[model samples]
Target: MDRRESGKTPRQLVPVVLTGAMGKYGGELWDAAERDGRIKPGRGPNFTKRVLPDLAPLLRKDALDQGIPRSAVDRSDRPTRGVLIPPEEGGPFPERLGPCGWSSEDPGEFQWDIVTRGRAHWLLARDAVATGWLAAAMHGLPHWADSEPVVFFSTHTRRSARSRFGAKFRTPPADLVTVRPDPLFPELRSVDAATAAVQCLSSVMRGKKTW
Candidate 1:
């Protein structure tokens, strides 16, 4: 049934969604939006921060549970710290990054069946699933089967480039656009990079003839 016919207003129509908002790419987009007056206080796509924990331990346990030989599972890359840390402890630098930790009460929910080295890919997959669910719930729909365009700003990492997690959605939006920063500007700070990226995206969104 149509929402209007059902006499219920949709929770809120999010015209734009910025995923990985805390990461380099997403952070850039967010900062740009703020600077350009596009985003106001409490007005924008739902901000979802991607938080990762050390996945080495969880992956090792998962491998063992899957009957993999102990020698086969590499423990050399095991993380020494959890994702969450005190702000005073030089918060969340590149060295402290890890996989998104599981918070489900059920132990079985924390399975690491995907045996790939792409921790970022795994995290992105989880994020896609979560956003899909959120869209469905907020719109009172069964799934993300609509044609609304979603603009995603991601880094130029190989894992993110090769990730097929977007397709995992039951009905992925066809107009989804992924924006990445120019490789030439590798030394650009987050805010600077974001400013450029957001400008490009804004042009595209405005139907301008530039990339």
Candidate 2:
């Protein structure tokens, strides 16, 4: 009865990751290989700086261009992981300038939300899955705002990540995932509303912010 001891393992869930469109737009940022992970037979960090290389620099200048003192600008290095959503702190999501630790209590300089930023992130990360309220909104539900933390459901090892403000990742059974049905990106998938509701409830039970 013990599957682990019986030499049996659970089946793997493989989500389809599309990058053709993004590759065309992004211009060969990174590659996804089987064993090596990143494209181009690379395994090291400096694998491919050319992929979305300009994003960080753009965000870095977001504050400095506004006359925020050079001392105030956060010159932190971009995160090494594949962040689905840019962290509000030290993230490269453009329009979100920071003192490297911007928050509700001490938001410095400026932070703007662009509705299409998710699309850009998806372009950069071909495996992202919008989840929770963000998924509901993507599935045509109304009343969702850009101010909320963007949620993405991922079971992929390298694709999943948790962050302070930007894209938040949730891993669940994902029994019934579905596409968000966008004209431009119909391939974008998500854990259905029921799964997302359960996830949100679980977050609340675990003492995490419900929203």
Model 1, 121-173: lDDT tens digits are: 23333333222222221122212222222223333222322332222233334
lDDT of 2 by residue, 50-88 (tens): 121122222445445656456534433222223222223
Q: Rate the local accuracy (lDDT) of all candidates.
A: 0.27, 0.38
What TM-score does each of the candidates earn? Answer: 0.20, 0.39
Q: What's model 2's overall lDDT?
A: 0.38
Worst 10 residues of 1 by lDDT: 101-110
lDDT of 2 at 128: 72
- Candidate 2: the clashing residue pairs are 29-51, 31-39, 85-167
| Regions of candidate 1 where Cα sits further than 4 Å from its true position | 1-50, 56-107, 110-171, 177-211
Global Cα RMSD, each model = 16.6, 19.8
Model 2: runs farther than 4 Å from truth? 1-115, 159-163, 174-176, 200-211
Q: 155 in model 1: Cα distance from truth in Å?
A: 19
